[model samples]
Target chain A: MVQINFAKREINCKLVYYGPGLSGKTTNLEVVHKKAPASKKGELTSIATEGDRTLFFDYMPLELGKVGGMNTKFQLYTVPGQVYYNATRKLVLQGADGVVFVADSQPDKMDENLESFQNLEENLREQGLDPKTIPMVLQWNKRDLPNVLTPEELDAKMNKYGAPTFEAVAVTGDGVFPTLKKLAQIVLEKLNREYGLQNDGPGGGSAPAKEPPKEKEPAKAPAAATPPPKKPAAEPPPAKEPVREPAKAKAQDDRAERERAERERERERERAEREREREKDRERDREKEARPKPRDFNVTPPAQEPAKKGGGKGVLLLLLLIAVIGGAVGAGFAGKLGPLQKHYDDHLRQHLGGGTPAGQ
Target chain B: MAMKPSDTDQKLRKQRLIFYEDDIGRINKALENYQNLSKSRCNMLIDVEGHPVTQVGSTEGINLETIAALVAASFAATKEVAKILGETEFSSLTHQGKNESIQLSIVGDRTILTTIFDSQDTTVGMVMFYTKELVEKLNAIFNEIKSRKDSGKPIFNDDFKDMSGVLDDMFGDV
Candidate 1:
């Protein structure tokens, strides 16, 4: 489905590249990503495995500045080509506005191409899309290789609805852009026919009517567009007004219905954005709560070592040890001095005469 | 000759979505509620075809474009798993991780809601609960969009004068 952003004056559409394994679906995207101007292309992202096989898909958003009157952007995607990846392929096919089926051109690969085409049809059916109606382009890739089925042969087998087909050597960038241009043209035409929309620009309502066959020749472009312009002057009203009048009324009704629905969605987006802002504020508050605080010192003492500083208790212990040793040495020296011994004996006899007589 | 059921149904089906100014607000509200409730790192509203419609939240380091594509692929694969197991389909799928996880569920039939969250900050239970509620809200909105009647007039009956120029500029002489 195409999304129109009136606020940005932009239109976004999805286009997928699908094929059997190694059929150059990814190569087509690689060429476009390589050749598209830097300004016109977004980053090319590939979600592949170690062997470089696309596991999920490849994505690139190309900006076509402005078409009709709005900024038109095309998102290109490629599904994994393996048959076992059918689930993934169906997923990528969902809501696709357009598709490009890149077929392997080798003669032996014909069966694979047919199988892939059937797969595409079945997948489109599951998504409620008709392969007959969806704007799809066929690319006969690896055209530069040998023993490949010719474009006509491949088209007969795979393009049952006669979608625009292209012959390409995707690795060399040949036919890639032409195929894309054709697809975009058809997609836009489909949008215009179904939704009353043309890319936003000059000749907005006047251009598509002049080239009706262009839609059929989506496979051959740059050349397909060479047809002479039709009654450009008389065609404006009959071409634009009559079609637009009934469409405008219906468009307005559609717009009303769409508006009602989009309004609710818009409100949800705003509410979510506001909630995100508030959540960020709450996260900041939590961080503040977890921060260190000076008040914590009141609960537990500050971490400084008093023992390592060697203060009052250490000095008192050293002084006590020195006094005990000095007393013991002095007693031994007094015993060895005779004069000092006689004085000591006189004092002993006076104080303890009864104890001395018992000793004698 | 009898036409197939799809051929007849195609005439009445609308293939595109049209938005007015007010619709943006409602979409935001639903997405905002989900992000808040889940505390997700990011949220993306994508069509089943892997196109991103709108996104919100902390999308840093996330390549939303790639995420949108892969989410659809993985979800589709999971649906196949359910079919193989004899079930109709899985309602939702969550890919858990040590630090981050992603939850994917359909909003209506055409859209998918993808949410990426951090397990360290929020629980999977919170993400699943809010995601389910958000899907219901979004489903209501998408149903309306899907039901819109389209005007059958050709949008650009005008010649594709600009298309050639675009192609030329994008792929010069290719």
Candidate 2:
């Protein structure tokens, strides 16, 4: 999960290291924790047995500095990789934004690797996450060990979704940071796409789009002719904008005022959202009341209220049909109405003639 | 409207864990109180996922990291045992040793409160009694932090750079 707290200006993301038992999932986290500076990393917590098999999981929170104007923190968790601990594994997989599957490279551990991969897929499916779409990286650990499968072989078996893969020893820290770095970049890119932010690649590529890159591109022209042309193409608009630099400052001030207004609107929206949620709870209650048809049909009055409201249009249509049928039947009796009118006229004439002698 | 599957997933992923200086101050205060009342030598507030959220008391020469991890694992294993026995969960676990004893209790939904004391100095009953109050106080602090809706802007702005520099320093010359 990538949590963005606008109020706090913080972005928190969870990355889980998953693999079979004894596959160095814990070791991967330990290496990163040991290597990460104190300022950048928090205390590494591991819940394992005396035998050092992780019982629950190992957690390390790393601050990867600011990106996209938010301080990004990655909470790294490694699930208990043993097969018997599948329940715990499922619990930890609940809200993962990205995953690093650490596959054991030893030949004997192939079955475990396959089984864990299957478990990961099943768990992700159960969580309603598409295994293919979630950002993932594969690390084939214990690469330094003899009689290990090649990276190609490991990928052939386990990397079904073709996530970028890395070869790692994990214990002596071989390929540890790169695995983390690549995963971080992929996850960040995933978020950038999700939130509609431009991909500011690991290097702050967009910020220096105008000046420094142009000078550097010319310097690298002898080595590669391809680099210089792209920046030169995008530079013209920015190059012409220096005359508007004074206005840019004013625009920045306006942006600040707009941001304050946005914050106020955000708070208002949040209050309205809470009200909506409360209303939804009432709706859910009514739905429950309407669910038991036979028993609650008479007992609950509101249950019938929805049916009436929903059927109101149908009821109106039925009444219109009846009215049209009645009109058609009256039209069929129009000839009968003419004869009755003649009989009434003859009766009226007889009464008036009696008063004035019949012949006259 | 029913949420789309991806939207629901995004909602699940969106958990903001912000610990500002105020939160740190409250946590340290509670730990101090817990230590004084329980006569515990050292105490730690650890997340259930096996990470230390904060710690207080004398942790000199103690590998608190390893202890926290093992304690969480042991507590989880015990909870599983309780489930097998048809118990919902045991609120607290106390281990008695010749010289030292450790008490572990659940704090909120995702954290563990651990207190270590010498058996001669403090009894389990005393520790448990004080820990109950500590949990309540800590829970309030956490809830307040979670519900905080401050409108002020964050200090870091365009002046911030070198996120990768932090990582570089972390892995430098290793």
The residue pairs found clashing in candidate 2 are A1-A97, A1-B13, A46-B69
Error of 1 at A132 (Å): 2.7
Best by lDDT: 1
> Once superposed on the true structure, which residue ranges of model 2 sit more than 4 Å away at CA?
A1-16, A21-82, A87-98, A104-112, A124-135, A141-157, A160-162, A169-174, A185-360, B1-9, B149-161, B171-174
C-alpha DockQ of every model: 0.20, 0.04
Q: Per-residue lDDT for A218 in model 2?
A: 14
- Number of clashing residue pairs in every model? 50, 3
Candidate 2, B18-89: lDDT as tens digits: 465446557877887677656677789876645556776656677665576567667777777799999977
Model 1, span A74-128: residue lDDT tens: 8899989999988778878877888999999999988888899899999998877
TM-score of each: 0.65, 0.54
Docking class of 2: incorrect
Candidate lDDT scores, in order, read 0.68, 0.65
**Candidate 2: deviation at residue B21, Å?**
2.2
